[model samples]
Target: MKFGNDRNSSRFRLPPSTAYRQAMRYDDKTLVVVGGSSGLGLATARAFTAGGGRVVIGGRSVERLEQAREVLGDAARTAVIDTGDTASVTRFFEAIEPIDYLFTPAASYTIAPFDHPDEAALASPFDGKFWGQVRCVRAAAPKLARDGAVVLMSGAASARPPKGAALYAAANGAVEAFGRGLAVDLAPVRVNVIAPGTIDGDLWRRRPAQVRAAAFAGQAAGSLVGRPGSEDEIAQAVLFLLTNGFTTGATLFADGGYSLR
Candidate 1:
């Protein structure tokens, strides 16, 4: 099941003037994207940069950060960060003073039977992915502008739990809940989560080509659109959430209808 682009089917749109304005919107604004080295994070950074936003990307890998900076061009900034470390999180935030948007697409996962879950595997996902976002927000909240927004990544697992995904499912669920709670607490500084499902991105490269193709086929069989989602599709959704002032405490699903299955 190959994920195809469907630009004509997009649910959101900006008028030519608005788009032109947005294309020049980032002249003075700054955006910090944690985990922006790849996948949805990288896509989101690209979208923001295209609209003239200055983006600072943070991740655990220096090589990946440099690579992302090269890909994102001169407007893109890079920082070394370990979400699991509170001090690192503080240092990363302190380095970037005024931020207009904080997007965190960082997360880890462990798959195992609940009867015999690995403790080490569970620690990273919970501490790094789950708690990492939480701490980042807490640290950045004070500096976030009144109109600023914090976008966190959740997944379809939060809504549609699969077999052998106990740890991941629970962690995603917590992310969803955290977004809602943070929205109320952070008021006016909008908070939201993107719960994408089976999106076509580099994250799946770990699987063999044939195995991944088969999994995508399974996704298409269950999807309302009959295919997995592309990186741009998810990027569009993230852009909408970032721009829509009326929406907050929401979970936008870009899962190609897999949650409906």
Candidate 2:
């Protein structure tokens, strides 16, 4: 069930009025999405392209990016970027044109107990999720359109830290703060954060079956909605942040009311 990707596909057709609204929502706009090869990033890229927005997807995996290019069709382009490396991120942005919007979900780090014996493991979240996003935004700042918007990915764990996720919580909290401060410092270039809850997506699907089941069950029990979120749901929230002119420095918790619990 490909949605909004194949324009002629009959399985997921939009109504006339809805189609009209989507036709040119992002016409002449170019969006750069780091970590867009899979999961939430890929879903957002597809949605943007469907709205007539040109998307430049950046990721560390060549094979995954190629796969995403197929899903996005001609409306999107792919680039290689290692968010953990400042030089790779700089080069990735340097090769691209001015961006009308930017959304970064790329991070490579481990989440562990605060009392974990390995010091590096304890510091991994800040190095990857926190600093990695900061680097990408810094590189893309000069190339961003004055009216453009930026959406940084956070997680519901920031607000409601569950067992064994204290470090992860702290990292997400930092991202939210950074989004607020960056919104002010970047002025006219809207900056926002999206803190999503547990999602039934690629990340979870790849885990061991028992582990995945246990995690999902716990997540369902913890959230107000009693279920995990979908990638498309989070993508919609991201689009709203990018297009809403009056929204900036706001943290949208698209967590199925998880944070409220």
Candidate 3:
């Protein structure tokens, strides 16, 4: 969506930031991304591989996993995992050893107003995103390295719920809280949350063009920055959480200040 008729939105591009420019050296490290087949997770996986880290990418789709492996090449290993299924999570971790970092962003759910009749729709966010991450962490605990970290995916909805997104917002809030509590529980193995704003990425691209445009415009108008964020930007933020030893029990809002407004 255009910022406005009078203003040139293209001029509002993000300035060069040190976060994306800084060198990340993860030569011998390994990253486990539960949703690494596409979008933000895929971006992070690519960045980690570029930093010389080995990645184990898990997703529900075998075809997508194979596609991701093609993009990541020998630096990555692919597996099928459905976070909503406990046994699937267990098997995904069992196949990989000594994980240096973990990021879970795979979730499938609906977001609608409270008046929606389908009970399953209301519960899907928690089932897919909140509890899904919980199951993965529980299963990965044994394989997680003491020096490693866990980064969970959350959304700006947790802070500011737009109309018809109350449950979605609540689920995201739960994930943020889960990250804090899990951080303490995991101890030396850090746990953090990346609550990103509306990103113009693969996820949104699947939606109708008109709907996608409207969502992007609305998100841009709400944020301090007058633009939607990129998958790569969120990817860099996740990497920061993964590599930073001092940070834990924290939720980093990479939402262009959407919550503030």
Whole-model Cα lDDT per candidate? 0.82, 0.92, 0.92
lDDT of 2 at 227: 91
* C-alpha RMSD in Å of predicted model 1 compared with the true structure: 6.6
lDDT (0-100) at residue 32 of candidate 1?
A: 90
For all predicted structures, in order, the TM-scores are: 0.87, 0.90, 0.91
Per-residue lDDT of 121-193 in model 2, one digit per residue for the tens?
A: 9889999899999999999999999999999999988998888889989999999999999999999999999
- Among residues 3 or more apart in sequence or in different chains, the pairs in candidate 2 whose N, CA or C atoms overlap within 3 Å are none
Residue-level lDDT tens digits of model 3 in 51-149? 899999999999999999999999999999999889888888888889999999999888868889999999889898999999999999988899999
| Native-to-model Cα distance after best TM-score fit, residue 13 in candidate 2, in Å | 24
- Displacement of residue 3 (Cα, Å) in model 3 is 41
Give the candidate order by descending TM-score: 3, 2, 1
lDDT of each residue in 1-261, candidate 1, tens digit only:
847655566644445865664554556778898999988888888888887888999999999999999999998999988887899999999988788888998766555556665687755456757898998998898899999888888888777766766777888889989999999999898999999878778787776999789868866887788887887778778877777799999999777775343
In candidate 1, position 252 carries an lDDT of: 92
Clashing pairs for model 3 are: none
lDDT of 1 at 56: 92
**lDDT score at residue 114, model 1, on the 0-100 scale:** 60
